[model samples]
Target: MTTPQTPGTWTRARAWLQTHPRAWDATLATAVLACMIVGSFADPGHHGGPKWGTRTPDAPSLTLMVLGAAALVLRRARPMTVLAATGALSLVELVTGDPRTPVAMCAVVALFTVAAHTDRTTTWRVALPTMTVLTAAGMLAGPLPWYAQENIAVFAWTGMAAAAGDAVRSRRDFVQAIRERAERAERTREEEARRRVAEERLRIARDLHDVVAHHIALVNVQAGVAAHVMDKRPDQAKEALAHVREASRSALNELRATVGLLRQTGDPEAPTEPAPGLHRLDELVDTFRHAGLTVEVARADHGTKLPAAVDLAAYRVIQEALTNVQKHAGSEAKAEVSVVRVGPGLEVTVLDDGPGHEGAPQDGGGHGLLGMRERVTALGGSCSAGPRPAGGFRVHAILPVQNHARQATAAEGTGNRV
Candidate 1:
């Protein structure tokens, strides 16, 4: 049994032909020349048919026919010029030669070349006159009679060549258009990827700023207190120094987590620690208290669980708020943090009692408030950071409690604990 042929073999053959265009053109030229030479000697004239008008061509006539067919070798390089040369030679053969030679073959090839490489208007412009003049010359001026089969054959061949070339040209244009569209789409995808990368870098920079600023501010304040009291109250100085170490350690850990996310590949062992959320609120408050800020915490959420993203956003907002109170609100500031569940979401509010400064702008000139609002907005939540009407600065964020991948992971952790 014979095996079926696959399209891959044909595809490879077509690719090879496309790569060797000059060889393909040379092959076409050779085939047309061979046909013209063979037809010249194969006397079709018969006792009664149209071949009755035939006679053998002479030596110079054969030479002229060869020259006409040879002109097609450069048809593709200069189609119109070659077509004109071949048309003139064919006219010469028609007017002077007996038993007409097939010099018209070269003109047909050149006309096809012109049509295939040019537009419809150009094809029409070139093809109509070419067909009319060549056919009229053969019919009116050749040795053959007016209604001879040879004259009609010239018209049919030229018209067919034009139509076939136009079809090929149309197919080529369509293929080129498809290739260009594909390239444009690929460029669009690359641009989109680059845009996403830039957005991610900005996000990471904001996270690093929030983390370093909050913890470092606490460390700076505690270090200053420790130095001022080291000679007088050794115990108080030691406690302040311990708080300094703890704040620095927290900053380093949070920094590692934020920076680890920037790694594009490979699980380089950084830290598998869970992100800080409501669970760490007490510790966060204790740090503020140690830094001489009296932080009061009130909760009405009643064990309401949150998605990891909302939890983290809530944590970051509160951290940045407290940090601002420490930095902008004077030493006498007392802050109140509230976490309450309302409707389908969790609301976190941080308020202070110190003398307030100018309100934080909505658009951004302050990184802390801007970063807080961005975090909340990304989660389909609303955030407000400004001076409270009564006393000091206020930060309020209401984040929805929707189920997501983070919630699922949190649930899994709870299950594993059980």
Candidate 2:
């Protein structure tokens, strides 16, 4: 078994230091000053091994070391200024001190800060000059020989610091870019999910409207007829009541199917009836005929098998159009429905020879015409509904016969060629 561990004192302290940059820089400067002061007392010229406390740095050397270390306190906020100040102090110590002090250590740290904060071009421009001037001063004017190890050490240490800082900067930039890309990708996925949800809601609303509007309109007409004729003619009233019952039953079945789309996966199974299509045009026209509206259907499309989406869109367009005509046109109105296959498309048109009504969908008071347009448009088709130039109203739609997969493949091919 594994156990989670709480943060230790050191971890907590490190986190706190990271949040307070000025304090951390001050701490670093103190440590560097301590190191420089201790190093100044060591002698490399001792007979045996190099010994500490065998020599003391002159006043000028001590002063340069203190100034260089003090400048590093503002290294992050003013990297370029710190580098210049420390470099000048190191050059002074290299030229004047008989035994050069460790003032150049502060310059190396400042150079590293500059590289980590600035771009590569700026770092390179600043670092090269600083390294050259410091190394040249140590080699040319110091009390020690030009070929001394200390002179070469300055060059090597400064180069390493600049390289290390640049590596840190590059890694940080790469990590930040990766984090931003992930966030943007997550946002895109969320937006796509929301868009799909909105589309699904609109689709369900249209389905409910189609089911309720068509069946209820028929039921309403039949009920009104049955109520009117009940006293005068019992037989005709019973027949009208039977028609109302049938219309209501059909409406209930369609409502169950439509509402079932919102059920959970483990819910009871819904009705398995196939969705109504152009194949059921006869049945659809009959219901309107029973309501006393004369409907005539003509077909020139042959027995063509359409993709499911196109078939459904065509059915819905016809259904909504007929519903509008039955509701808006007078009892003596006659309707004509035509299905024609032209070129690569199937066209459906509905015309009713009724005096145009102000309450019609063409006047923008209902969703019947709008739903038809949405259904056709979703299938990459076109739909138009308007009052006829002669009389009555007309609804026409043209739907492409291609399935989604074929259309997608053709689109991909075109994109590749382009």
Give the TM-scores of the predictions, in the order they appear.
Answer: 0.69, 0.92
Q: List the residue pairs that clash in candidate 2.
A: none
Go through the candidates in order and give each one's C-alpha lDDT. Answer: 0.84, 0.89
- How does model 1 fare in lDDT? 0.84
What's each prediction's clash count?
1, 0
| Residue lDDT tens for model 2, 1-418 | 9899999999998899899999899889999999998888887666776698767888988888889888999999999899999998998888888776889999999999999998899888988998899899989888889998789989998999899999989999999999999999999999999999999999999989998999999998999999999999989999999999999999999899888889888899977888878888898889888888999999999888887778878888888888888888888889999999997899999999898767887575678878888888988889998888999998999999855648767988999999
lDDT of 1 by residue, 236-257 (tens): 9999999999999999999999
Candidate 1's displacement at residue 290, Å, is: 2.6
lDDT of candidate model 2 versus the reference: 0.89
Model 1 misplaced stretches (Cα beyond 4 Å): 1-42, 46-98, 118-156, 163-171, 174-178, 264-267, 300-305, 340-346, 358-366, 380-382, 398-418
- Residue pair clashes in candidate 1: 45-51
